[model samples]
Target: MHDLIVSPFLDGFLAVRPGSPACVRLPTDLYEEVRAGADNTVPAWLVQTAADAWSLDLDGKAARSALLVREPTELAFARASWEINLYCNFGCKHCYLGERPLAGLSWDDKVKLIDIFRDSGVLWLQITGGEPTVDPDFEGAYRYAYRQGMMLTVSTNASRLWKPDLLRLFRDCPPYRVVVSMYGATEESFDELTQRKGAWKNFRKLMAAARNAALPLRVSIVVTDDNAHEVDAMKAVVQGWGLDHHVYTNMQPTFSGEGDPLLVQSTEFLRKRPVFEGCNAGVTFFHADPHAKVSICKIGRDDQIDLMTEGIDGLRRLGEISDRLMLRTGGCTGCSLSGSCRVCRPLAKVYQEAKAPLGMYCQHGDTKEMVHP
Candidate 1:
């Protein structure tokens, strides 16, 4: 397996180490030189540069086939998020995927989907789920994507992280990051929030194992009404474990426009988001559901492109779709606060459809002036 991945990133090329965050930008001429080098060998200067960046000695004459993998396309995407399956072990109240259906593409089809992702220029792929690790073909898919030179981020619940086979796989080919969601601080609150008995115990055991193995891990502190009081305790727990964490208090309506999740929102913990800025979703990134249906992003699922049928060419239409979906329409039509709106148009539409309070997503709401508690 190659330790370095040379891939087209946006308008340029990047040489990055698998399982590491370090990257080096290669100029057009250097990229062409590497691609056209004799016997697919890495140049001496690049070897020394990579050694300096990673603090590891490398063979100057290493065959490119042995030391690196290059992406085959210039029209590559910078990032993508894929929901391998919607199936999840935990039934949390604040989950945006409300239905929690047990469904996804078969192994053969999944392989095809990954190929499309690779061919379409996906460099950084986030494998998520209703809990991605629980998928039956997750290991196969993960190994395949890693081999394809795509840096991966697994968004999991940490329930299955302790499995010996999984630990070995991660040790052999580490993901760029494993994002685990922390439901609550205490076992009682944790299990109650997920509505799954023994979940807290399983999570604790797996987290310890993962830490012992030195796997790259980050924590997302999910704050809801049930665990609102334990927010501080949650932070302390993560800190004690020596893991980086981010607090997430805002709860969105379900993909189908249901407001059930909004009921669990902890108003006290809600933090104001930064000002709305333009995003590269669909232009530089995209989201894919289990069945290989591509959308602008997780939040905007309209006009999905069927990658399984239409193939990668289907993505060409997303640029147009992104523009249309971002228009200030429906409830937001003619809104005076459009310039300073925090939520994007598609997300705002979902909130409006669910009849969510303006205070939750709108700057013009009565609670817009709320301060962090």
Candidate 2:
């Protein structure tokens, strides 16, 4: 049978189209007889491989098969997301944390955790937070991780980007990328969203600092109903500055079930049931909260496993949960949502308790379909 290995680095398996046919997972050692695909459009490393014949016999293999591989496969992770600190000075209207950063792993513990990711073969690391700069040891943590050979991505508000220490750090060791989230296009709208006056002026200064330092930068405008009218203006302003930018309309859900009324996308724009083959969340990507709980993905936080201990083995275990969830389940059994739920898992507690969509999960789109408890 013709097959192609989708991700050799993790959960190595054949790539198949949505509802293509039945497929099975195999051990790495059993993978044999690989030939490269001739198509230049495909990844050169994605080789075409064939499966071995079924052997029902007990004394199955030869001594030569045992020595084919000289060593056990190395643990490899392509990317990671770290919530370094959940504390932010600004009270964003759409923040998911919805709380002042009260507690988390200490600075030294954070450094050790960075080492763990490095040792486990994570090449790209994203350091995020309620705002990463809020952490006391932000500079130290940033420098330590970059020195370990990780290409880092930092998401911040630009509030602390120009601090003497951070500016020095950036000049010495530039990050792979920096993303600043602009809540609005003008001072009034920006101040309204962050509830902090003079924030837009600070944002402009941050841009000036970024330009002066020649740091790689990308800006994203969070388009909400409150600032929907400014979407085109924001895009034009950001592009006019000669830097890359994008816009997102989705709103974050707070753990307390207090979702923002003004940020939900319209039904016409709501994502409906679309065909998807599969996702690489726990398999290829992982998100760790400030407390060090590693979840399969951002939306699957409540059911996450602890990564404070067991380290790599703990991360590897996440794949099993992801694999199981990717299969059909009750209510989804033979239902249309089954094929479409490639990476989807259960939504937060409010949805389960209410049996309805919450926030962006609200495919029903309008307020009429969403019942407020």
Candidate 3:
């Protein structure tokens, strides 16, 4: 049977034989319809293809392996993300970690953190930061995780991926993938958004070095109003470079409690999405911030407790707290739009109130239209 991999947010998917190089990134519309399943609008051939590969009946009624939702906390948490620190060398105007005193778990503390994740049954680790490359202890941390047999997924700006120390270390202990965030298409637009001179040059340098070494690299372009004009150009450039990439439009609230959607894309550009229903966060997947605060996800930071103080049972204890905080208030519960509403408690906190539909609702009237990958 073939294995299907679908991203809930990125609007892309890959279907491949689990251990072989046989894979295809399905077209967006086909992926969406297959993900939609019963309520799919596509022709029967597409659904039939998906079912045959995933070993489902021709009707496509059976849940796709990629779409199956796993429940439970500690016992099932094989995927987790660790925000090493919110420190970065470059200044991006749209950063959620906005200008804060750099604070993070020390080397020993981080090692302990890694152990905690492993003990909690984590098998896939996501290493992210304001820029993970900026951390001195990153190599040690990465090595420790690697030795534990956890598949690593790193997020970086590609600024220091070319360093002899890092290149050698990662070359020896390679991650499953490394994602580089692209700010803009041109040097001028790059500097305009990132506010760093010569950063464009540095990025190119790292790119060249990485290409020469043949590193497993992918690109993620943060779609924003400022760089909207260059989105096509950026995608073209990355594609021309023989890179696989995806574009994300959401600009979340700042880490400083500033509910500013500063870098949000224009309404015309953002794909209309249905209100989010369930998430993998906290249940099967989780997030650990720089200060050891464990939360459901990045946007769910405010709803989290301190991991160091709360211990491994942090999420278990936070159940009641989440229940209480998730109670619908204001016009949301009473409004007819509540059922179709895509805004959840975590994202709701980003605005002045929980009520949404600010034209952000899904294009299709039903929740089935929601694209996972």
Candidate 4:
């Protein structure tokens, strides 16, 4: 049978290009699918080889064996998300944390957690929060992690970063990424999501600060019904700023509060095109919340394994969970949600119907269903 090796470049559609009659790359080996339509697409051999290493398993393994060997690391990193806080000032219509950042760990607990992550060789730590910068000890925590040789990332609203000291801190030790969420191009659109009047101004200033620092930055805009038309305009603005970035559309609804009730689209008016396949949350990446909760995707934090206690083995155990949720869970087995689910996991606490899947959002002119549960 023909063998296919998946690579980081493959997302949403490319995966299914080889269609049901393709093969894929596994961690320790290759996975050759007798029927490739659902899992992947058959691209030109050169294209596939350039993105991934693959070969035809002419040794008759598929004929003799129904089971295939797979590796999790090929898709998932050891650690991707570092939950810094549960609290967020936005109290967005859809909030996954459910609660705000309540209490923080003691200094000892903080040190221990960082120590564990360091010991595990986790270099990229995504520092998120209801608002991570809001953490009373955010600077301290960031310094500690930096000192430990961990690269940092922050997902924030960009409102709290106006302080001169904070700006300097970012300039000196800027995160590998500072993913600022821009809800809209105008105040009306943005304020609706953030429910704050000055948010637009704050975000703009935040961008200015980053520009002044010449720090690396990525602007993440959540496309909803209201601002879907402005996706390209927004992207152009970021581009005009001369920053390296990608604008993405989330298929999942907001975790809490009023969700984005925007209609899904098939065409691309914005720079961000429709991602036919969903995220590979568990398969390609994983998250560890501030509470030490380990999940396949950041949105799957509600129902998750506490990695703080379970450790690396616990992450490995998640492979079974990911497969079960993606493969055996009825309609979701081969749905379009697979591509955008870069942050998806089976450990979510909420469950929606098959057609009305959890975290449903618009993509490619269709209402692409997503799962957070």
Candidate 5:
């Protein structure tokens, strides 16, 4: 039998309420305490004793294990991201949000957003947009998220990041991390991808300044047919930074959609790569849009019930959404690749629009290989 594995989050609590099934292992003393509504504390010795009593597994090993179960909070790591707006200044060829530039968010709305996220009980918030910095009240919104104890991460072009005060603000009030998309490693390539001249210089200067400030940074590289050949080179560049990089395979062509046009690769190109066959949206993680609309993940967002209004309680309502509408249910059952399926809600949306075969719809082709490798 496969050994059991435990998640770190289970370290202290005997029970975890992740908006769904709670994992509980009853110990007589603990159960009594809980029944009495006592301020029960789980000590290390108690945990070891309980594990011994249950013979639980640890991390797929035969050692001690922590009680764990699939739940909404566990899904998506229980983190929350609010796509404040879709409008971005640079209308790149591969944007998923499909937001228009110059269409900024209102100040009153920004205040309300702070309250919404703060009240949601989610301690993580991401401010994204066409260009979040472009928001008229961008600083105010950011300060609000910070004041509320929500860790912040900004996905940006880094054009205005050169501003000293802004850099100081981020370095002093550092969030968990900031992710910047580097279209290309060089000037010509980057300019081509962003369709904005001088963008490369701006990125280079800002990244250097951020490095000086010791800001936590992550880089994402979008792989496409146009730049597929450069994957190896990009990997080298990412390695040079001594930081991990994320590479996304281009989404497949869509019949008609609001998303950017894709650089469709051939079937051979996809098959020659690694294979991932299962999806972990509702099971491992979930995605929510700007309005708190929930999707199993980005791939299925267009198809799931809105959770903002319904709250976490709405997941049960998926039972009524009909299997036919849930594409993965029909295509994924018992598939050998089920464990590694890369399909997510956003990718699923692309598939629905392109009607492309499942293999062709992922952001990066069917593999989790380190791009640099």
Candidate 6:
């Protein structure tokens, strides 16, 4: 029920609103004072500051319902992404998930998982799936995470964005952002790409509803051989809606090392990725699959920690796991171009396992031939 959350962030303390991006960093002493202060009571100065920062009319004696102060923890995480379920209504050939199964934690277990995220100090949580919005317990899980004071982002296909219940939930408690994937600019191409009829109609409704509700929406233009021809048209459509968008040109093999998804790659639209600089991954962030199995990152699923059994304490091993995963061993060992490799070790391993063409991910491939003029 709190409107503001003050929690330990990295080496400092940060104050953030649940649905908003604006954050205020508090000094260590101030954070300690807030934590040690009487229950439901915040400093008068903070109350005034919060009111001004978020434009809320806070009482002089800030109640616990208005402000939440989380105790400091040994956990270093500030962000995490969870796959609530792996089910989807549309079957896109380029999907990396490959198989779409309706499986996830129970509602009771889901509540526990959300609590674990809070206890582990996850501030920014992304709710994703084959299609997150279509999950049966999506509403319950989303609401619980929101109430727990985690800033959320939902990744979806926008097929169900126009649903009345979903609209009401988002209107009441907006997500940090709703990231929708754009398959095509026209109905025919859209349905063709998703292999689902009426998908375009649903997408149009989703856009209109989101615009009318004034929701924070961003688009991911997914370019594949099927929809590559509509790339410009897709951008124009999103631009007309006055929404921000990012183009995703590269397609990868499926998580299970299947090369089928690679076949759909739009070589003309493919963009070169930057060199792989080390990422925080398991150090500061981790990914949880539908079964609550934790991995350093989405691509590196080896040596997973079962959150359901190990609980939050399980995250302790992630740092070491991350270090080991980043090592240039296995298929990457003795490679001369490792320094300039665009993909991470884990992703490269996936490509190697699938026997994917070097042209798809390796710099040794002819870049000039792949890039469009």
Indicate the TM-score of model 6: 0.94
Q: Could you tell me which residue pairs clash in candidate 1? A: none
State candidate 3's TM-score. Answer: 0.73
Model 6 over residues 147-223: C-alpha lDDT tens digits? 88788999999888888899999977789999999999888889988999999988998799988988889999999
Q: Compose the digit string of candidate 2's lDDT tens values, residues 65-156.
A: 21111121356666789988889878878676657665788877787788777765665678998898888878888888766656678899
Candidate 5 C-alpha lDDT tens digits along 1-373: 1121122222222332211122445444554443343223344443455466444323222121222211113222334555565556675666655536455346665566565444434444567766777666677778666655455778787777878878866755565677777777777777777788888888888878877777677788766555667777877876887666788665443324533454434222343334444443454234455555655554455456555455456654433342333444443445565445555434554554554544454444455432210
lDDT of 5 at 116: 48
Clashes of 4: 58
Q: Lowest-lDDT window of 10 residues in candidate 3?
A: 1-10
lDDT of 3 by residue, 191-291 (tens): 77788987788888898888777777899987777688888999998898898998877665565545345435555567655656756666666788887
What are the TM-scores, per candidate, against the unseen true structure? 0.95, 0.73, 0.73, 0.63, 0.63, 0.94
Per-residue lDDT for 221 in model 6? 96
The local distance difference test score of each candidate is 0.87, 0.62, 0.66, 0.55, 0.53, 0.87
Tens digits of per-residue lDDT for model 1, 245-346: 999999998988788999998888888988788788899899999889999999999899999899888988989999999998876779889999998988
Residue 199 error, candidate 6, Å? 0.6
Superior candidate under TM-score, 3 versus 6: 6
Top-scoring candidate (TM-score): 1
Identify the superior model by lDDT, candidate 3 or candidate 5. 3
Better-scoring candidate (TM-score), 3 or 4: 3
Better of 2 and 6 by TM-score: 6
Which residue runs does candidate 3 get wrong by more than 4 Å? 1-74, 259-264, 318-327, 353-373
